[model samples]
Target: MTADGERQVRAILETRTRAFGRRDAATAAAGYDDDLVLYDVVGSFVRRGEDPTGRLERWIASYRTGIGHEIRDLEVTAGADLAFCHFLVRISGTMRDGTEVGMWVRATTCLRRQGDAWTIVHEHASVPFDADTGHAVLRGEL
Candidate 1:
């Protein structure tokens, strides 16, 4: 049962990643619960409820097209009705103004099983910063 839960949670993560890569906001949002809370890398440190959806939309809108995401070093732990996953992700794309954008970020997600489906209840994304300079170290490799 634990193995099954792990697989199901992995599938949900994969689906969400693919949806984001394809810039399909609706499909990406499907993996999250209605009461989802998120700590996003780009905006406010904490966002509650449907705010993550708005953030996602803003990100998608920034790309002219061809947005893509790659996940690395993913680790998942699952029990009967709860799961958690952590991973490093790289997102790359062209901005609407023709600027190239690429970033490597850390991600963590907590999921809850509702019936047979797994939904993200909480998520956090972050990038390390330079402690002395108080600036984001965005160029670091994954």
Candidate 2:
């Protein structure tokens, strides 16, 4: 990875990290492209440019506490105007109904340089599931 490119991309991702920690849907949404496509681990499998901030706001409201995220094994490949990264992230927090959730999910993000800044154009996140039971493994180390 180019040091400068990686540093810039990582900084952009840090906005998301902070957004998740603070439950700031607007901040999280601002880092994405206007026409972003996302495949998230919860609710919708795929979504396209459809009021992501509002969707995130509703999701955050379901949580009693700010969602926690811990990123690991991040790998970034950046070019002059295009970049992509993959990483593992742990999502954990309590729900409004008093349920505690913790899960390890894999994430991939693609970014494109828009003038002086980079914005995420596509993202995919998923949790592994058991083959036999077809149940998501929501609380385990990867």
Candidate 3:
């Protein structure tokens, strides 16, 4: 990818992270489509609704209170105006009752260009493969 394309991809994702970590639902929702889809590996969630901003806010709040994800690596593959971003995420933090929680997962996001901007069209997220099972067991049949 060209440097500018790379920057655009990173900026898009960073905006999402900032929104998520700060519990800014509006910002987070901007990264996705109006009819966005999300699957949570940890919560076993398969959700499609009118608005997903609320869910983004709630996820951030939960991260601050009990759990959250850290972006370990983000690889963006771009084709013309489209991008497929692959993520390695680490889940961590302690709950209110002091429960330690930590794990790693893999996520995928499909983005499309909207004029000079970009937005997510489809997203499929999941946990990494297990050493024993040698298969992904998080979400979306990874």
Candidate 4:
């Protein structure tokens, strides 16, 4: 049997992925801890901020009126209720103004286990891929 902390961290990853896949902002935000931190490749990074709902709203806007994202090569590392996930995201589609575009970014997120629940505390993402190579290169893949 998994310990509570471990289970909570795993749950966060699972729920976060599910929420993102379904474009459910509220559910996605549920994965965050009360003292949450997030790093986004396209948007602003939230540090020591209390509100994660704004990020969720941006995610909603992207799905509703902006680009769409595809996640791949997702790998999560966890110690008890604390965890981090790294992955490559491919974004494509048009902006609300009808400008078509596509891009890819790599990122990692940090999470904490809180009272049988998993919440994200910090996230750091960057576009580290090189055009010289065909695909995205992660920490170990490089």
| Candidate number with greatest TM-score | 2
Candidates, ranked, lDDT: 2, 1, 3, 4
Cα lDDT of model 1 by residue, 1-142, tens digit: 4989889888887887888778887777888888888888866777786555666788899899857788899999998888999999888889999998788889999999989989999999898989999988767644
> Per-model C-alpha lDDT, please?
0.84, 0.88, 0.70, 0.64
| lDDT value, residue 113 of candidate 2 | 88
TM-score of each: 0.92, 0.93, 0.74, 0.66
Instruction: Give the better candidate number (2 or 4) by TM-score.
Output: 2
Q: What is the C-alpha RMSD of each candidate to the true structure, in Å?
A: 1.6, 1.3, 4.5, 5.1
Give the poorly placed runs of model 1, Cα more than 4 Å off. Answer: 51-54
Which structure is stronger by TM-score: 1 or 2? 2
Instruction: Summing lDDT over every window of 10 consecutive residues in candidate 2, give the lowest-scoring window.
Output: 133-142
Task: Give the residue spans of candidate 2 off by over 4 A.
Answer: none
Candidates by TM-score, descending order: 2, 1, 3, 4
Candidate 1 collision pairs: none
Write down the RMSD of candidate 4 (Cα, Å): 5.1
